[model samples]
Target: MKPLLVVFVFLFLWDPVLAEMHKKCYKNGICRLECYESEMLVAYCMFQLECCVKGNPAP
Candidate 1:
């Protein structure tokens, strides 16, 4: 029972985390150009741009 509960919890959170990767790409234009291997880079770049700049997107 405990194991099943743990699995369920993980599954619920896993989908969101995975889905966010694609969502992040849409939020940033560069995502269309990025490959699977470049996902982390795109996401990091987006996060930094969001934090570093005000309203302006990263180039």
Candidate 2:
């Protein structure tokens, strides 16, 4: 029971950190493109953008 409680607590705390990281990276990519920066420098950003867009579709 103690281990299960620890696991649940870890998950609850982990999600927000992951989400914040994702948002930061996403915004960084958008800023790079908006400033007309080179794609080669932020190529990973392109992939991230595509993945998020595809993962979440309009209702």
Candidate 3:
């Protein structure tokens, strides 16, 4: 019973993490905004990309 509970918890957290991994990290609007917003959008985009990559490492 305990093992099953642990597995269920693991699975619950796992799906969202995997889903986040496949999400696209950038949009064109952010690119344009970054040009004028002191690069804030660029940093945000890069952070999101890193999150995606960390969740799903490249080959």
Order of the predicted models by lDDT, top scorer first: 1, 3, 2
lDDT of 3 by residue, 1-59 (tens): 99999999999987765655444555323322123322323224332433111222233
Candidate with the greatest TM-score versus the true structure: 3
Backbone clash numbers for all candidates listed:
0, 0, 0
Q: TM-scores of the models, in the given order? A: 0.42, 0.39, 0.45
Candidate 1 regions with alpha-carbon error over 4 angstroms: 25-59
Model 3 reaches what TM-score against the true structure? 0.45
Looking at model 2, how many pairs of residues clash? 0
The lDDT for every candidate, in the order shown, is 0.44, 0.42, 0.43
Better of 1 and 3 by lDDT: 1
Residue 49's lDDT in candidate 2: 36
Per-residue lDDT tens digits for candidate 1, residues 1-59, read 99999999999887755554445333443422234432334234332331121143346
Candidate number with the higher lDDT (1 or 2): 1
Q: Which segments of model 3 are wrong by more than 4 Å?
A: 27-59
Model 2: weakest 10-residue lDDT segment is 48-57
Best candidate according to lDDT? 1
lDDT, candidate 2, 4-37, per-residue tens: 9999999998776555435534424432222221
RMSD of each: 8.0, 10.8, 11.6
Model 2 segments more than 4 A misplaced: 25-59
